[model samples]
Target: MKITVLIENTKGELEDLINEHGLSLYIEKGNKRILFDTGKTNNFIVNAQKLGINLENIDVVVLSHGHADHGGGLLSFLKINNRAKIYMKRKVFGDYYSGNILFKKSIGINKEVFEKYSSRIEYIDNFTEIMEDVFIITDIQRNHKVPEGNKYLFVKEGTKIVNDKFEHELIMVIKENKGICMFSGCSHNGAVNMIEAVNKLFPGTSIKALIGGFHLAKIPAIDIFSTSQDEIDLIINKIVNEKIEKVYTGHCTGEKAYNKLKQGLGNKIEYIRTGSEVQI
Candidate 1:
């Protein structure tokens, strides 16, 4: 399977393409094309065009979670390819704010687009398979020491603002010849948990690659908090000890956090830019 990044926070030599605090990936496994998540705005489309990727060829669209940065572009994507089935967890809706009480930001998907595309959605709370070995994994149990939860990310329940349980989060796990590659949309539930989820689903399966947001990288320019160094070390240690071969991280993964991992993992860890591609 090969994955192409259509949208992300960083842009490389293709500086002409737009950038945003979002994530979108195009996965090609066999003849089936899958769109992982549509980034914020229409930047995914622009980057895909520049990368010579035809968005209309996508056969299935999978949302890792409900957050706006991940789910926001689906509306525009449907305009281009409306036939692809959207697979996601049920809780990916409603008002989600991710900032301090003084400055709350709407982080959920646009209600208008969600309503319009409701007919195309496939809510999968349990294990789901797109084709043969390509799967959507959910119900992760975070067992490692990371941020317990994001204090800034919350959900509104009537008049009460409560912490989001993140049931909406789902991961993509593709079985390869050597092992499996796990794709966590945001890792909001924690990377360790995501790995654990994979392990639990398919016992003794080796993890070949880990791609997508680590949620430890700090993006100061956008005011997103970074995970503590101690926690970052734990995460890196887990990845190394588990023997994950490749890691391509960005978006909310934070620049500093990624560099820190690079120091320990060397070439095994790398940042994936907007037009980058990874084959496994």
Candidate 2:
């Protein structure tokens, strides 16, 4: 499988490529062409063209969650790629917001885009195999610590704005010859839990790699991470114990947290930036 970073929070060595506070990966597995998350805007589309990635040829588009940074490019994608089926979890259109009661900002996808492309969008509420070896798992176990940053994320329930449970998040697993590669958007459900969920679903299958943001950064303010040092250590410990071969993380995973993880995981971890590419 070949994965190309279409857009990310940081720029790559290529000067032409642009970066944003989002994530998007162009994946090619066998005959299947998958686009995971579209970053926060049409910038991903622009970056894809520079990387020689034809978005029109995408066979499938998966929105990691309701967050705008991940699915905000839906309208642009729909305008360019009409044949590809877009998949997202149920309730992904909920009014997702970030910040405390004093201040909040909309962080969810544009409902207008969803309404316009409703025909092309498929809602997956349970474990589903969208293709032969490509699977989407929504039953993420919450046995481990969720992102500390999640406390600030809210979803509107009736007239009350409550803490987001992140039921709209899903994990993508692709079975490869070596093992399975997992793709997550922000991992609001927690990376450790995602690993365990995949392990339980596919017993005895080795997890070759995990890609995407771990949501370990401080929200509203990115200068410092919201996750405590102990929590970061615990997460690192869990990833090491799971024996995941490689972990490509960035975007919501703060720089400090990444460094901490790097110290623990050594060369097993890498920081993914725009124009980054990985082959598994």
Candidate 3:
């Protein structure tokens, strides 16, 4: 499998690539060409062009959650790619927000985009294999504590704005001959819980790689960690115990949190940014 960082929070070695406060990965597995996310803007489209990637030929597009940073490029993607099927959770159109009582901002996708491209969008509410070897899992078990940063995220229910339960978030698992590679947008459900959930679903299968943000950092700000040292340590312990071969993280994972994880996991963990590429 080959994964190319179409867009990410930080700039990488390539000076020409664009960076933003979002995440997007172009994945090529066998004959399948998949786009993990579209970042927060059309910058992903620009970066793809520079990277010699042809978005028009992409076979599938997966929006990992309802957050704007993850799905903001949907409009641009729909305008360019006419044939790829897009998959997301059923409730991903809910009003999602960030911040506390003092202030809040809309962090969800624009409903107009969904309405415009309704025919190409697939709303998934359960575990489904979109194709052979490609699976989407939404029933994430809450076996561990959710992200501390999640407290600031909210979803509208009736007339009340309540804490988001993250039911709209989903994990993508791609099965290969050696093992499986899991892709998460931002682990608001908790990385440890996600790992355990995948383990339970696919029994003795070894996880070769785990990619995407862990939600261990505060949003709307940088250089701030939302989780405590103890929580970070616990998460590191779980990754080590699970024997996950590699973890590629960035975006909301926070620089401090990523460094802390690096100290614990050593060369097992890597920070991915725009223009980065990985082969597994």
Arrange candidates by lDDT, descending.
3, 2, 1
- 30-128 per-residue lDDT for model 1 (tens digits): 888989999988889988898889999899999998888899898899989968999988888778877776777778898886688789888887888
lDDT of 2 by residue, 97-145 (tens): 9988899999889888878888998999899999989999999989988
Which pairs clash in the backbone of model 2?
A: none
Q: After superposition, how far is residue 226 of candidate 1 from its true place, in Å?
A: 3.2
lDDT of each: 0.83, 0.89, 0.92
Question: Which residue window of length 10 is worst by lDDT in model 2?
Answer: 218-227
In angstroms, how far off is 28's CA in candidate 1? 0.8
TM-score of each: 0.95, 0.98, 0.98
Instruction: Look at candidate 2 and tell me the lDDT of residue 35.
Output: 93
lDDT of 3 by residue, 101-187 (tens): 888898999888888999999999888999889999989989889999899999999999999999999999999899999999999
**What ordering of candidates by TM-score runs from best to worst?**
3, 2, 1
Q: How does residue 38 of candidate 2 score in lDDT?
A: 93
Task: Give the local distance difference test score of model 1.
Answer: 0.83
Model with the higher lDDT, candidate 1 or 3: 3
